[model samples]
Target chain A: MKEIMAIVRMKKTGATKKALVATGVAGFTAVKVIGRGKLVTDTDELEKCREKLLALGLDEVSDAGDTETLVTSFLDGSRFFPRRLFTILAHDEDVPRIIEAITTANRTDYGIGDGTIFVLPVADAVRVRTGEAGEAAIW
Target chain B: MLLIRAIVRPEKKDEVLAGLSEAGFNAATMVDVVGRGKQKGIKIGGMVYDEIPKILILVVIPDGEKEKVVKVILSTARSRNEGAFGDGKIFVSPVEEAYTISKNALGL
Candidate 1:
């Protein structure tokens, strides 16, 4: 089985969800992730965003997984940056088209921001929701 | 077979996967990666940030499903705010072969 992972901006979550659901591989695991990238915001606006998100109870932990991306001109210089994690387990055969869909979804909707994606082999898989193991669970 | 590499805003990962899975390309692999585009990373004050968090999803597909997956990623990742920035990027390449190491088998 393969595990497809993606990280995107918080604002794009809704569209991302629609894209995934459309593909039959809907099961996924997600997390709120923080990042420090090249945002195009001025000092004042940056501080304002930092203050607002902090007030909203968003605490960004240091990224230990190296899962963050940086784009200088995203948003034509908008400096606010927030990210999310999306992971799925699937069979090896299903990878290519799913990736294509994901790219299409991300590109058309990203608007002003840029991000990155990579795929790695899944050594194993188990359904956390139902405890089903191996390929059966992933599929 | 073809390999599709989509560097999208990390948030779009789930929706994109859900769409591809539903389309019959049910399996894919993912990795956590960091990189920047011509935009050249974000600049705050004197410091320039070059690295961003991105999820890399790797999937091998028979020729048939390529278009479907591409379409799904495109439509979903688009935004109503056309003036904003940081939407993400995608790349596709051909695969000469595929195999499941554990199964010790060739071809999907």
Candidate 2:
């Protein structure tokens, strides 16, 4: 068994769910998560701010005194963004299909925040109701 | 790396998290879930509450740190000194790889 986890944009959740259901996924767990990517600085945005500072006659942005201020102003304050985390368990054969469905649904024109898919190994699964185990329980 | 998933009593969530943090394993994901264990559910005065609320805590760490992490959870998540049913259960699985979404770098 495989545990397929996808961290996607909050707005794309509906589309992702529909796509999963369409692919015949029996069930999945969705959690509201606040997370941020590792990129703390966006070079393009920084460059834009640099230009704005130069326009304002503040050429000391490169100096240590104003560096902190410049960086702080560029930051929106909240480092973490809201996201939806979907955890899906499936047979090995279904892993590829599920991943494809999620990607197709969450992909956007910008292509950066579509989200990430992680495949992990699941040693076993059990159905509490019937005491079923392994593949029997998953189906 | 390994992913340690512990389905613990909702009330004990804070203790477990604190234990982990103090032990230097601060990164974890928590999800509220409902399920039953070996004892099944609980029986009340006249009704059977099969679905019990639980907090599933997920922590990914280096494989060598599994023992330390699990020990922390076990000590803190117990209901009582002697421990009892419904305290919770833990599952450790292998994580092939991890990626940081923003950095687009491999391995966490």
Candidate 3:
């Protein structure tokens, strides 16, 4: 079995879901995650993220209302971008098809944070209800 | 530490939790998710229900205790003596890195 984790733009999630369902991938898990790639180019968006993060008490900032410090941090370092993570487990033979479906759904005219897909080998799977394991557990 | 992900029936969540706690494994993340095994949900009459709700329990534990932890989940997550379909699944994977946010520490 293969576990595929696709981090995608929130705007494209609906289409991605439709495409995956159409490909006969029955079930998946979607998680909202905040992450960043290499840099933050948009100052406006960076300010907003800083504000939200500080408001949520995730920053080790001396002052909560320091917009200056926030701006400085945004300009100098990393920034968080909103992303949706989709986790799908499928048979090895069907992985390529599933990736194709995801790619087609999330394709963009110009790609930046279009998202990323990480595929990993699964040691085993068990169907809790039926006591099925291995390939039989993934359907 | 290895990350053990167990997808099990929602109804059996408490048992799994109790069993794990009893086994001295404390930390875990639980998420409510929808999926189905080979049965592909339940088909009643002409209705095809393709997705079934399940709980996914994620536990990052010491690698050496993988088998013991899996045993705890299995015994608690299993439906019957012989087990049945849709009982749930457990997936084990390697954890390359880990951190504790409060302590600002990393696993070496």
Best by DockQ: 2
lDDT (tens digit, per residue) of candidate 2 on B46-106: 8888789998877778779989999999999998799988888999888865654433445
lDDT of 3 by residue, A1-139 (tens): 8887676788988998999999999699998765433344677766665566556663455554575566566444333456787899888889878877777778674344566565667788898999999988888
lDDT of 3 by residue, B26-97 (tens): 444566788978887889899988788998876667678998999999999999889988899999887543
Off by over 4 Å in 1: A1-139, B81-84
The number of the candidate with the highest lDDT is: 2
How many clashes in each structure?
A: 71, 0, 18
CAPRI docking class of candidate 2:
incorrect
Score every model by TM-score.
0.42, 0.59, 0.46
Rank order (by DockQ, best first): 2, 3, 1
RMSD of each: 18.4, 8.1, 12.7
> Can you list each candidate's DockQ?
0.02, 0.17, 0.03
lDDT of residue A68 for candidate 1: 23
Give me the runs in candidate 3 sitting further than 4 Å from their true place.
A1-139
lDDT of 3 at B105: 33
Residue-by-residue lDDT tens digits, candidate 1, A71-108 = 21222232224567677666788777666556566663
Candidate 3, residue B12: lDDT: 97
Top candidate, metric TM-score = 2
- What TM-score number comes out for model 2? 0.59
